[model samples]
Target chain A: MRRSLFPRLGLLLGLLFLWLPVLLLAGYAFSDARIPFQWGGFSWRWFVALAGNERLLAAAWLSLRVAASAATLAVVLGGCIGWVLARQGPFRGRPLFGALAGAPLVLPDVVTGLSLLLFFVLLEGATGWPAERGATTILLAHATIGGAYAAVLVQARLATLERELEEAARDLGAGPATTFATITLPLLAPSLVAGWLLAFTLSLDDVVVASFVSGPAGTTLPMVVFSMLRLGLTPEINALAVVILLLALTSAGGALLLLRGVLGRR
Target chain B: MSRPLLSLRGLSRRFGETVALDRLDLDVPPGEFLALLGGSGSGKSTLLRVIAGFEAPDAGQVLFEGRDLAGVPPHARPLNMMFQSYALFPHLTVAGNVAYGLRREGVARAERHRRVAEALAMVGLEEFGRRLPHRLSGGQRQRVALARVLVKRPRLLLLDEPLGALDAGLRERTGFELRALQRETGAAFIMVTHDQSEALALADRVAVLEQGRLVQLGPPRAVYERPATRFVASFLGGANVLEGRPDGAGGLDCPLLGGTLRPAETLPEGCTACALRPERIALRSGASGPNTASGTIEEVAFRGDDSLLLVRMPGGAVLRVGHAEEDGAPPPRGSTVQLSWEAAAVVPLLG
Candidate 1:
């Protein structure tokens, strides 16, 4: 009993450490206090104030657009890479190709941001395409980083999938493209959705990468929130944080349910 | 035989260091049921895959209806395979799975539904049309897989260990159903299997392979009663092999049995081995005959209907002799016994 008690307590402590800050912030979001830490009774004033903040609303809209674009791009690019790596047998430089495909997942975000920024500058100097870095540059950067994560998820899912299913499809008179459409894609749908949601969340709040890539026109909601932190905490920001947290939770819960359904059926 | 529906000439495939198939030549007549029988690593599955166009042969030609299938993909081939796992689509309904091939063929919606229902009814799965694959039992899932392939109505069907995943009782029932289905469809089937009894009972002809080469191929009775090679003899029914040479006195000098024996048939030139089925030999005590050997009984195993006796000769070679329990009580272990058989029972092995 004593031995088990220690582990139980450790788990409780770990959960507390992880959830305490978010719980405190959520509680403060309902307060009408001028100071964030001081509770001044529950009110809906800060939520209303947040609705009226045009600059913050504009940044939030920009962030949503960028996240959706980046996540969609990540799913397409990463899914192809994962399929090739999983299905195609041994080929020249496979090891090197696999390592490079997975490189962005482990690379430091600061390094990824700095390198992407440098590449954009060089490209603009060379071809003058993407003449100025803004939403397009930020979306591309996030997609590059998000794609590595999506590829890993897709590869893991493909590994659990039986190769015989594809072979059977082909044997039943479905060509390569048809087999992918009718068998492989339907089987991989859940993983792809999960990958898209994860990439969206990663792009939504990525301050470091976005800071390096974004220009004045590309100021995302996270950048605005980071700047607001220097002026001390306020209830309006707390309300914004709560709204963002709720959206993240909903998508995360969706991903978990989709994955569980896939696993349970198998 | 009528013109072969499919002909494989000098098919060879090597996986780096292992030769999966070597110089295999075979022909499948229309509507013939052929079983490729071998142990693991004997290339039975590889041969099926090559014929299905899933694997490319290192050398040789696959002619389907006299057309060279050199670069044809599996989907373009006029054949289908029932995988060992069944490989049922977990997400699709039974009816949907059966209609998948029809959909690929661009069959009209009404015709596709009619055919799908017909296929399901043939497999006795008409009531399971709307159910998903995971909802069905193992036997039911196997039937659905069968319906999926049969709906295509190809001239040839490849089955890779179709009954491998079933329990023993289910295996027998399913095997009967599968053979009946083949007869009903009248499609030639090339099945790969490792089970000797399954191959012999279901296939009209059995192709026995060893070390990536076809050792023997013939009707089931012929292959079982007259195995051409030592491998086939030893592999099929566990026949005891005796190696010897002609003694120049109208008898075979077998060092293993420590005796000179006269066989019913004249020994062909270069014949050096013969196989004697254990059931063909009879046990006696204090007896002498033209084809007889004396040995001490080593052990007796009591099977349900029959008992097997192991006789150890003075030359140290052990021979197995099977006798019906109803014949009489088995000879006690460690007793001296005379083992004898008819001259015709000794089948000469070519290799």
Candidate 2:
């Protein structure tokens, strides 16, 4: 009992350290006070106010749209990149390709955002495409970073997968496309879903990159929350935070359940 | 005779500076179970891959039924492979895996199910159709892989060390099952294995590879009793090799044996070595045979049905002699005995 006491205490302290502020915020969401750190009374007025804030609702919807689009785009492009890196044998540009794929992972988000902003500006100046920055720019930036995460996750999983499975498929009369669709894709489903969820969360919570690329019409939820925090904290923002937290928690839990089901069956 | 079902003409492949396969020619007849036997790095697996269309040769052609297999992808070839790992799809049920090839061939859904069920029944996995691969034992997985390949009804099947993964008892049982399956299906089998016993037991003919070249190819009995070279003699089983110079009289002046040894056939001008199987040497009491060597027994090993006696001669060479246990109690260690072998048991080896 004495030996287990220290570890149990350490775990409790770690959970409290991580969750204390979020719990405090959740408590404020239920309070009727406009100011933080002081409760007026138990009431649901802030939640009603959150529902009436049209701009906040719009920002939340926009964030959802961007996260879904970015996650999907990341999975497609990153799945391809992961396949090439993991399955293909040593080739002429393999080193360079691997380095490029992994570059965004090590590079800071601020640097990535700045570089993407500059690239969009130069691209617009030269091609006259993407006439204005809004949802498109934010999506492009989020996908760029999100794709790197997906690639790294997928490549690691693919590396551990047996190569004989693909060869066996081919020997069993499956063409390359058929093998990819049936064997490779089905086997990689768990990892792909995990990658998609990670990309979704990253896009939803993004502030630095989204700020650099987003225009007037593309104020995502994080941007709105950031601007509201600058103006001073409010119970309405606390309510919005609780809602976002719930969304993230539900998605994470759902992904865990999905992956557990897949892995457990195998 | 009918033309061979598959033929490799001057096939060669190189990986960097190492030659994985030299310019080699081989033929596989219809319904013939051929085993490629060699040690590691002998190019057995490479040759199997080439025939399966997994690896393209650097030169020459792989011909199937007189048509060149060049430019044909592995999937398009009328051949299938049983991987060493059994490579069953973990996500699929046993029935799903068996149906994969039939589905790819555009067989109707009803026919695919029928054929899959039949194949699984053939491998005795009729009740395991719904179970996933991970749920099966090693032997069961192997059977599933075989069912998957057999369902395709390919013209040829390439097995890379098919029984290498199983335990000894399972390997023996599976070996018989594999032979029985091949006979029932009448599909030509080309197996690659480093285990000589497996090759001898399963193959109608064995091809022994050395340094990426075919050193010997013939019936297993001929290859074992009459090895073509020193390497073949040692690789197949234990053979006492006596090195010497040909003595002008159809015999070799072998210092190792401390006398001139006569061979069954006349030695060529510069024959330098002869191999004699340990079992061919007989142990007799007292010195009294046409070709006899007096020696003291050095070691006695009891092998249940037979006893192996190592005899040390005057020249300090230890000759291994195998005799049945019924040959009376083996002369104890350090006891003097005379070893005799017939001239016909002596095989002359070149180089």
Candidate 3:
């Protein structure tokens, strides 16, 4: 019998080739030595030092705040748009609307970040509503990117929803709004959760957009990592990176598992 | 006059260039189980949708209890549609689906639960209320859809091919059940279907539609016995059409039928197409009678209940004769036989 195990081996090699550096960084975070590459006895000295690292924690906290705001805004606004696109027929300029919603997905993150920064500067010069760029500005920039992802996820879930089920609810005497709240929303919950988590994760990991828009108040986790890299690579920074990496992985894995469970059920 | 529960006076809908419903007028008495029967694109479904308010007609008014149904959305129509797909909400349990209507009507929570239980019991799904739609069988899903519709207690009910998704055996059983439930509820039930047997079995009266126009409307017996046009006669059942005129030669001789087999019914005004149902004819050989015609059996099919004999007449015309299987096997293929039907059995449909 031909097992064809070569593909699996190749996939493993490819994954190792990509994440080996990340694993080495995590490994070195525990090493007590001048050169991280040299074998040194494992210790929690860096992890302990990371606890006293106020600047890194502040950056991480800012990332969390921006991610939370961005995710909440993205999910709410994207959900509405996704719902409309799913239920309503394609009206005039629907293609253009769809393109605008999905444009950030294909565009480079740097381009998206720079363009959003430019747009914000223009708006401030004209309207002067957000007079200064800061956390709010960073969140707005991240949300623009995060919103595209949320909209795409919600749209996929909505498209897979059976049309007859909603019609059934309507026939049962539900008004349009009631049907949406009672039937549509409950069924769309899992997707909403997944989309929110994904948007939050993306916003938390974002560096380019945060760098472009951040003024005084905001210094996201990635920005902190990049800034610290400009200085020397401290074991404290290594510990922080490992922690953030673990958090991101956990959130993503949880969302994926939840989505699979939902899709697997009848 | 018990006011018609639903009335459509000259209802018409046009989708750009295509006429879906063309000036169709119908009045459904309260609790009458009427079947709108037609082939695909025959406007039967369009008529049902119009009545349900899923579609608004370009012209004509929908009157439910004499109130105009204009600007009324499907959700507020006081009518429910049993979709061909059954359309049970997959996320909700059977109880939830049933209670959906009650909840929307602002019924008390306890009252909604009680009614949902009652509806489920009505469909014999009381114990299965906690199950989701996809978890149930097709027939069970259909029952859940029925329960959901009945829970709202609409004055008029619309069904679009309600049993279209069921297997043959299940469909037969469900059809009888649905008719019984309709009678028990005493609501005006309108159904659209392309299956002629279903229409005959379920409808108190059947309306045959063709090309966006109703060709015939009457009780099952009346429509079957006395078709108003050729299309109705052909669609309702398999029939042998013989074109002839009553020349009254010697003793009324007809040219097309080869011999003067006594005129059945007053032959229509001109050359008439005589419709004789397959089951009405008797097959024989050698001897001739008042309604006898000689033919050779072209094919013999053994259908479980009956045997069908396809006979080729002298002039290349073919006629099918259905005889009980217990009555003995059909005349073997290639055998010559004389086909005969009673004069009254021959239905004169069109000229």
Candidate 4:
């Protein structure tokens, strides 16, 4: 009984430690008072105020658009990269390619952001192709890091797949493209979906890289939230936090249901 | 025969320091069942893969219907392989798996369904079409793999250790089913297996491989009774090999047997040894034949149908002799007995 008590206490403490801040934010979101951490009364005006904030609404929309695009791009490009690394045997420069694929995993986000900034600057000067840094630049930056994450997930999944499945497909009259479509792609669907979700969450939460690449007019939701917190605490920001939390939770739940339905059929 | 449906001319494949296949030439006629028998890493699998176009030979031509399969891919080849693992797609139903080949060939949906039903019926899995591969028994999955390949109506089928994954009882039953199916389909089959009994039972012709070389290729009986090399003799079944020198006549002077003995066939110039099956040697109370060795029985083992007796010769060599159970009670251990065999049972092994 005593031994079980310690583990039970540890689990309770861990849950409290993680959820206390979110609970506090939720409490303040409903407070009538303008100052945070001091509840005057219960009111829904902050949520109404949040709905009226046009800049916040625009930033939130931009973040969603960027995350959706980045996640999609990551799934396609990163899936290809992973398939090459896992299936193509001992090609020239394979070690170099492998190291590059793993670079984003170990490199600091600050370093990655700064390097992307420099790359965009040089690219703009030489090619005049991304004339201004904004949502496009931010999308490219998020995709680069998100694709790395997707590649790692996909490569791990491919490693466990049976090689004979693809060979059997070929033996049954499937060409290389047909085998990839009919055999490899279906087998990898679950991992690809999971990787896309992870990249979507990562891009949604990312502030550092977006700050480095985003233009003055194109502030993302994280940048807005960060700037708001830096100035002073406000109930409106707490309301926005509550809203974002609900959105994240609802999407995560929806993704779970979607994955269960998709994978269960197999 | 029948223009050699498939012919391999001087096929060779090397993996760095090790040669997987060394200048191997083979021919498979239409509707023939051929078993490539060898131990692990003996190039039997390599030969099958080469013919299937999975592994390209370093220097040789794979001719199918007299057309060189130089740049032909596995998907384009008129052959399908049943992997040792069965390699059924876990995501597809039995009918779906069997239909995959036809679907890839762009067959119409109606035709594909009809053929899949026909194939499933052929393998006795007509009612199992809706079930997934993982839900089936090991034997059922094996049948599904067979159906998947057979649905393609391939000119040749490559089977890599087809029954290696089944239990002993299931293996025996599946062996008969596979043979019957092959006869019904009338498609050439090239199966690779290390089980000598399985090969001899299922294959019309058995090709024995040793260290990336074809040691012998003949009918199962010929390969078993008249093995061409010392390796084939020991690998196929039990054999007592005695080192000997040709006596310049029709006999061989063997030190292990303690006497010169006549060989069944004329010994070629420089024959080195003679291989005799243990069951062929007769044990009697006294010396009675030209090829006779007086020895004391060292051990007796009862194997239900036969009793194996180990006889120790005067020169300290122990030779195994097998006697049928109904022949009589085996001579007691340590009892003196004379072992005799007919001259025709002795095969002259050259190397």
What TM-score results for chain B in every one of the models?
Answer: 0.96, 0.95, 0.93, 0.96
Poorest 10 consecutive residues by lDDT, candidate 1 chain A: A257-266
Residue A236 displacement (Å), model 4: 3.2
> RMSD to the native, candidate 4?
2.8
Q: Compared with the true structure, what per-residue lDDT tens digits does model 2 show for residues B1-351? A: 889999989999999998989988899999999999999999999998888788899998999999999989999998899999999998888898899999899999999999999999999999999899989999999999999999998779999999999999999999999999999999999999999999999999999998789889999999999888888887887788888888888888777777667887798777798888989988765755336788888899998999998988888788889978788888799998888889989888875
Docking class of 2: medium
lDDT by residue for model 1 over A1-266, one digit each (tens)?
44668889899999999999999998998987998878999899999999999989899999999999999999999998888788788899999999999999889989999999999999999999788899999999999888888888898899999999999999998999999999999899888997898889899999999999878778998999899889776788889889988988897788788777764543
Kindly report the docking quality category of candidate 1: medium
| Residues A152-226 of candidate 4: C-alpha lDDT, one tens digit per residue | 889988999999999999999899999988888888988898889888988988999999988876688888889
lDDT of 4 by residue, B1-351 (tens): 379999999989998989999998899999999999999999999888888888999998999999999899999998889999988987788898999999989999999999999999999999998887888999999999999999989879999999999999999999999999999999999999999999999999999998788889999999999988899988888788888777787888877777666787788787888888889999765665458888888899999999998888887778889989889889899998887888998898966
Model 3: CA > 4 A from native: A1-25, A34-39, A249-266, B241-263, B270-272, B286-292
* Model 2: DockQ vs. true structure: 0.62
- What range of 10 consecutive residues in model 2 chain A has the weakest lDDT sum? A257-266
Interface CA RMSD, all predictions: 2.9, 1.8, 2.8, 1.5
Best by lDDT: 1
- Ordered by TM-score, highest first, the candidates read 1, 2, 4, 3
lDDT measured at residue B324 in model 1 versus the true structure, 0 to 100 = 91
Q: Give every collision pair in model 4.
A: none
Q: Cα lDDT of all candidates, in order?
A: 0.90, 0.89, 0.82, 0.89
Ranking by DockQ: 2, 4, 1, 3
Please count the clashing residue pairs in each candidate, in the order shown.
0, 0, 0, 0
